[model samples]
Target: MKIAVYGASGYQGKLVLTELARRDIETVLAGRNRARLEEAASAIGLPDAERRSADASDHEALVSAFRGCDAVINCAGPFTSSGEAVVRAAIAAGCHYVDTSGEQLYVKKIFDTFTTEAENAGVTVVPAANDGCVPVDLMAHILADRLEPVEEIITTHVVVGGGGMSRGSLRSVVETIDAIKAGGLAYTDGDWHPGVPARRTAITLPGQSEATPVMAFPVPEVVTIPRHIRVRRVQGLTEAALGDRLNTPLTPEIIESLPEGPDGDGRRTQHFTYVLDATGIDGRRARGIVQGPDTYGTTAVIAVEGARRLIAEPAKPGVLAPAQAYPSTAFLDFLVPHGIQWIIEDAPAT
Candidate 1:
């Protein structure tokens, strides 16, 4: 199956292309930069992979690039701006679609606007296919299976490396923060409620030497999972990895002050560990953990693996999150050989 990767010049896009090539899948690299796309294709040793210049915001260009491809993996973002257009193009071209979008607003828009269209088009459109939604969605489903009447779920992400954010990721962060400041809604008290980034707290994880400070924030998973599972409360924490310092605080101001950079100078080998916890009505609890390196690489892995399965087996036609479209164990299994560690643990009852 031939797949087209949009935004093929960026870090995540390059990783996606690399993964697809590793699987011996033919790929068409679509992006705004011809030189960068060619460079990435050459780097992946797929010099003959088709290259097409297309603006992600241009529906006609995206459609033209997507034409004749079996599936398209979108690596472009802030998806809030371009996601719908890509989905439209995919539907128009009768191609399966997947993306790394983590914007809650855009994800809601996809569900509201494209669910019927995707179903009618006989194609599957999967969003937030990365760690943000996929792993947590899987965890929520597993937790719900073990306990009746789950009331809440939380995902905390502790990412150490890939310190420099891509321009698209940085833009998404700024927009999300701005929306929160403008009284945007978040899932709370079993419903969508107005919320903001509150405060920082220290958290100690198993195998860690000290408590790390994390910013309690709302990510898209918190908004998406509750719709599928019987959860009333969902929240997420994005934290900086801890080193020698104990209780190093990552204040709101510090998180807001992160540099939007030409990221190559920073340390390339970064690590991440995320814990997903859930609470049920009868006091039963479940937790799942995933650890990996290079946030961009992991995101690409998720997207590539999703596309690979979609093209190979053709999942049911509908718009879906990763967890809904693929079996949780199979998805987690795909990541194991790539150096990702998955663990499920039960917390002792108090």
Candidate 2:
């Protein structure tokens, strides 16, 4: 099936285009710059792929660019600002949409604002379709089932050996400073709580003996996991050092000074582990961990796969969490060949 890659001139967009090519899927490159889209396409040997340059402000152009495409994989960010227009245009074009957005509030906005519109238009929109959200959300569903009568779910992740952050990624970091500063929104007792304290101070990463000290980190699972899973609480955690790093004030100037993105070797050497800890009302507990490769690369894979599923298998049309849109086990199995391994088992409720 044919798909459109909005922001195809950017880091994650280029990665998504590469993955689509690897799968032999036809794709149209789209962004605000035709020349850059052309360069990105030619760099990947897709010189003839359709190129559509549409600034996010121009609604009709985006719709035209996405028209005739089965789905659109959006890699644009600071999605907090530039995302809604693309989402609107994709749905208006009758194309299902998936965006690599990790901004907690943006996901909440997409859910709150587009659910009814997407449902009426019979279009699916899955935001935060990235490494962090997809795997953790999927595993949360998996573990919650095993930890039935689940009352709480805590998600944490660790990444090692990353090349560097992309300019867009860094800019997104600045744009989403509010969520990052607040450690993200938390779901508790059937309501969302803001500026919550770090409920747990430390969590053990898989393959490590000692518990790593952590701080509340913004992860969209705090927003998406509760959509399908019956749970009272959800929160995200990451290493303390990283939290301190993000706590620094980041501005456009700082982001502009960074490299465009990680080169192939930089991406290949990176690895990550996402862990989901679930607590049931009965005091039974379970944990699931997903170990995978490069953060950006894996995010591209997740976004493309999610879009492919949205078009081919088709979930009930509307905004959906990764797990709500498809079978968590099936999706997890799909990741196996991509260098992702995961499992869920009983854990002591201590």
Candidate 3:
């Protein structure tokens, strides 16, 4: 299948291009920078794939760039500003669309505004195709489905040993500072509530000695899971330190000085552990944990994989969450061999 990667020269974009090549899929390296797109194509040894310059702000240019491609994977962010335009272009071109946007507000917009348009165009629009929340969203489905009659889901993410955010990731955080400062978000009683702070609590990790302090934070999963599961409450948690850093505002100078791309060695050394606990009204509980590579690598692999599956077996057209857009276990299983380690456990009512 032929896929076009907008923002092809950026950090996550490069990784997406690499994985697409490994799968033997044809690709188009696309962005506003012609030289950089060509350079990226050459670096990935995909000299034959198309390289085109198209700015996200130019609708016609994006439509032109996306034409003739089966799918388009957008790696550019602060998606609040750029994501909808790309989605519109993809729909206009009748191409399936996916993006690595973990921004909750943007993600909600995709589902709210584009679901019908994408369905009419016979293509799926999937957002949050990243470590930010897709895996956790899928796991929520797996565990909730297994337990049956799920009531509440509490998910915690630990950056294994901690790591630095990629420049693009930092930019995403900076772009959404207002939302972060309002505090973490959660879903309860069919409405989203903001101004929720990360509640400090101790939890045991897979191979850890003592319980570690983790604080609740907002995640896109809180928005995506309800599309499939009927849970009444969903809450996200991450390490307190990282959560604090993520909510911290960035100055214009600080944003300008951030590295333009991910450090290869630095990314490899970074790993993550995500744990989800589900409780039923009957007092039964289930827990699951997923460990994987850093955010950029994980997002790249999953986005490419999602594209591959969408091409091979298309989802019923619409804007859907990662889990809703694909077979839950099948999609989750696809990540296992790619270095996603997971374990799910069940317990009787307490």
Candidate 4:
């Protein structure tokens, strides 16, 4: 099956192209820079892959780039500014769409604005189908459904030792820093409240004896988790310093001054864990923890694998959370060979 990798020359996009190559999947390298796209393909040993120069602002070019593909894995973002055009192009091309966005606002926008048109075009638009979004959503469903109609679902992400941010990642930070403060958005009693506190200060992640200090940070799961489970509330948290780091104002010049991205060895040094807790109405609780290596590396797998699943079978069209598009168990299990591990267990009496 043929898939298109938009922003194919960027760090994450090239990683995705590498994953597709490993899977022996045919791909189209699509982005604004035809030279960089060609370089990316040659670097990945896919010298024969078609290179399409489709700038995000050029709608017609984007559609043409994706026209014959079964799906498009969009790796171009700070999605807030340019995402809609890409989504529109994918739908117009009548192809399934997935993107590696970590922005909550972008995720919400896709679900809100594209649902009708995506369904009408019979294309599944899965936004934030990446390392940060998908696993947490899937794990939330796996845990929350067991205690359906739960009072709350809390998701925390702990990342230890990773290469510094890529320039593109830094750009996303510049795009989202203001909105990410104070926990992004929280789902409460059937309504989403923005810029709220996490109401939690410390949490003990799985396998840790001491609790790590945490603060509310915007995570895409805040938009996704409540959709599948009957939880009255959902909140997301990450390390306190991480949440605080958003305080550092990022400018285009500052991002350009940073390193291009991590090398393969630096990427391999990253390890991430998602701890999802679901509390039932009766105060009973369960927690699911998904652990994996390499944040950007895993994202490549998630995006490519997500595209493969969408193209493998048709799902009811429209916007879908990652778990909504694929089975939690199957997808999580699929990551077993990728140095990923996870488990669900009863939360200790509190």
Candidate 5:
């Protein structure tokens, strides 16, 4: 299976390349910076990896880069700007498309506009193929089966350690904050409602030292999951520490003040834990916990494995979420052998 990766020099790009190498799949690394692309491919031990120069923002260049590839994995972010162009190029090139887009608007737009075209083209287009929807998608599937009439679903993500964020990721964070400040709308109460950042709230994780404050944010998975599952409400939260020792709120000012390069100390180790809770009409509930590495690395792991499945399995052509594209058991089975742990529990009715 031959795959072309856009933004193939970023942190997530390198990790995905590494995972692809482990699976012995051929990859073409395409991005804006030729030098960075070469460096990342070499660092990941893919000496024979093909290199192509293409500006992600330029539609013509993107189309040329995607031509003749069986699949394309997009790690480019701020998807609000570059996503449509890439999707159009992938569709024109007759390739399966997958991305790590966490922007709700882009996901919805693709579902509405390109889903039919992709199906007609016999290509599979998957958005938010990373941790953004995979964990929550799995949780929602689990709860949908256990609960007779589910009312609401909430997912809280607690990420620890600063694992070297890339420029693309930083830019996405800034854009998302800007949108929130402008009073964006989120689906709530069975309708699109105005949404804002978290003021301040404390919550405890299973293996954490103490309770920490988490900021509620709008993520694509929150909107994506509810479309498949019958639920009245769904939300997502991202919680991180202020520093090495204190848990500080992720205020807009702080998000604005983040430095550009060398995001954190080289010795820094990162951790993440997600709690998924679902409530049903009969008072029965289900909760699941998933823990893993830094955000970028985890995303790469999911993307690479997802692509491998697409190559190795018999998959129908269409846009799908992680949980929908691959069987939940098949997906989770691949992760466990790679050191990811999942804990699932069912609560007795009270």
Candidate 6:
């Protein structure tokens, strides 16, 4: 099946192309820059892949680019700016949609604004199709589904790798801070509520004795988890170092001054672990841990696999989350060979 990847010249887009090539699926490398798209396609050994120049701001051009493709994977980030346009284009072009967006605002906007239209058009729009919240969302679904009437859930994660920030990641942070300023938000008592400033907590990583610092940070899980599970509350936390960096204030000028793109240490192997703890209203709790390759690589895997599923068997037409779009266990297991693994340990009620 043929697919299109927007922002094909960007970092995430490059990884997605690599994964699609591994799966032997035809793809269209599309973006605003013709030169970069050609360079990226050749660098990735996809010289024969189709190339289309489509600016995110030009809805007509984007629609033209998406037309006739089975699916479109949007690798562009800071979705607050370009996400809506791409989704509109995909819907207009009658193609399934997937994206690596981690912004809660964008997810909310997508669900709130596009669900009905996408449903009417027989299109599937899956947002946050990445490690940012897919793992946490799936873990929450697995644990909560096992024990009904779950009261709360807390997801904590730590990234252990040598790669520095990419341009897209840096821009995503800038946009997140701007969204947070517009209005603080989180889940409470099974509802969206005003968010509180995040604080740090010390937790020991599985199989490690030393306690690492973490802090409650905003993630897409806060918006997606409630869509399926009847949880009273949900929050996501990240390593203290990353948390502090995200919390720092940055002006548009300052953001423009930061590194323009990410440079990975070729030799370093990056990985991450996400621990999800769920509590039942009856006072019982369950914990699940997921480990996977570096964030960018895992994101590519998720997006490509998700697209494969969509093309193989079209999902129910509507805006869906990663966990909701596919079977939880099967989908998670599909990535095991690609460095994704998980284990759940449940404790008896006290």
Q: Which has the greatest lDDT? A: 2
lDDT of 6 by residue, 75-169 (tens): 98878899999999999999999999878778888999999999999999998898757877887899988766887777776765655656787
| 194-262: candidate 5 lDDT, tens digit per residue | 564443366666767888776565667766676667777676665645223222345556645764333
Candidate 4: which stretches are off by over 4 Å? none
Q: How do all the candidates rank in terms of lDDT, highest first? A: 2, 4, 3, 6, 1, 5
Question: Would you list the clashing residue pairs of candidate 1?
Answer: 161-270
RMSD of 6: 2.6
lDDT (Cα, tens digit) per residue for candidate 2, span 230-304: 888898888887866766777777777777988888888788888888999889899888888788989988999
Those runs of model 1 whose alpha carbons end farther than 4 Å from true positions after fitting are: 161-163, 180-185, 188-191, 196-204, 208-215, 240-268
lDDT assessment of candidate 3: 0.82
Q: Model 5 segments beyond 4 Å from truth?
A: 162-164, 180-186, 189-192, 196-204, 208-214, 240-268, 348-350
Model 4 per-residue lDDT tens digits across residues 1-350: 99999989998899999999999999999999888888898888887889999989989999999999999999988788888899999999999999999998888888989999999999899999888788888888888767877898888888556777789988987877777664688899897888677768999878789999998878898898877788898998888878556777788988888777888888888888888888898888999888888888899999999999999966679999888899999999999899989889997645
What is the lDDT of every predicted structure here? 0.75, 0.88, 0.82, 0.87, 0.72, 0.82
Candidate 4 least-lDDT 10 residues: 174-183
- TM for candidate 1 is 0.84
Task: Give the winner by lDDT: 1 or 5.
Answer: 1
Query: Per-residue error at 173 for model 2, in Å?
Result: 0.5
Per-model TM-score on C-alpha atoms: 0.84, 0.97, 0.93, 0.97, 0.85, 0.91
Worst 10 residues of 5 by lDDT: 240-249
Q: How many residue pairs clash per model?
A: 1, 0, 0, 0, 0, 2
Off-target runs (Cα >4 Å) in candidate 6 are 178-184, 197-200, 208-213, 247-268, 348-350
What is the clash count of model 4? Answer: 0
Off by over 4 Å in 2: none
lDDT of 5: 0.72
